[model samples]
Target: MGKIIISENVTLDGVVEDPTGDEGSVSWFTRIGDADRAAWAEVEHEEAVGAAALLMGRRTHAYFLHRGWASRTDEWADRLRALPKYVVSSSAVADAGWGEATVLAGDVVKEVAKLKEEVTGEIVVYGSGKLVPALLEHDLADELRLMIYPFVVGTGARLFPETSAVKPARLIGARPVGTALALLTYELVHP
Candidate 1:
């Protein structure tokens, strides 16, 4: 079976929302600076190349599909545009222009498991706050690759929401990218 990995950008306090100051609570994009952007670019490039498919929530999918990865000529744009994308949302509608996007309508875990079986490479989830906890709860996520920024945002969407039950995970690796960001990889330990 293929691995389901979450690749997210989070603050020290675990805030994962509106980092680009795009009308949200905390501004993480401003804090990242130029050097940090370069580091992130490198990380994204590597991840994009390895991932066979991209899974995202409605908001995140619309954001990237409209903003950065829409154009085929845009930097690292082809990587995102080419990959098969799955969007999970009950209310929000998807853009018709975004190529090869399938809305996940049924049971999220079952759908994801079906996708994992079909995919040959890594199945990557990016900035899907609502979907992450569900993935974890269902024990569907195989790995987590977090780009942890040093700054703390006290209020915003968190990377990991509080769960009633404990799901064990093991730290597999850590790599410091520039001064502010660290790439942390963790593997879920199945019982």
Candidate 2:
């Protein structure tokens, strides 16, 4: 079975929303220097290269499409454009149009469980705020790769919601990705 990995860019306080500050929120991601940003990009590219496919929510899929990330000429962008994508959405979408993608609109748990059985290697999820929480709740997510920024956004969307049931995760890797960013990888332990 393939591993479902939730990869996210989060702030120090665990906020995962408004990385670009386009929504009038503080953009902690862009606060870092150019070299630091480049370092983070390099790390992201490596992750992309290792991933067998990309998974995300409809909003995130649209956000990247609208921003023209698929249209870029860089190696990282090209890799993203080439990968197969799966978008979790409620509405019907004939085609993703970004690349080889399919819209998953049925029971998310069933669809993702089947996807894990069908594919091999890492199935990486990026910026799927709603989907991530649901996946975790359903015990569908296998791993989490978080790129933590230095700034703490006082208020915004969070990666982990308030949960009474403790989800046990084993730390697999941890490293600094520049002067201001840190990359932490955790493997979720299921009972």
User: Which candidate number has the best TM-score?
Assistant: 2
Per-residue alpha-carbon lDDT of candidate 1 for residues 50-138, written as tens digits (9 for 90 to 100): 98898888888878866756655855777777888888877555555556788887888888889889888898998877899999888
On a 0 to 100 scale, what is the lDDT of residue 108 in model 1?
88
Off by over 4 Å in 1: 91-97
Per-residue lDDT of model 2, residues 14-85, tens digit only? 999979988888878788999899999999999999999998999888888888785688999989988888
Q: Please list the residue runs of candidate 2 whose C-alpha ends up more than 4 Å from where it truly belongs after superposition.
A: 94-97
- Residue 162 CA error for candidate 2 (Å)? 2.8
Task: Give the lowest summed-lDDT range of ten residues in model 2.
Answer: 92-101
Q: Let me know the TM-score candidate 1 reaches against the reference structure.
A: 0.92
Candidates in order have lDDT scores of 0.83, 0.89
Candidate 2 versus truth, CA RMSD in Å, comes to 1.4
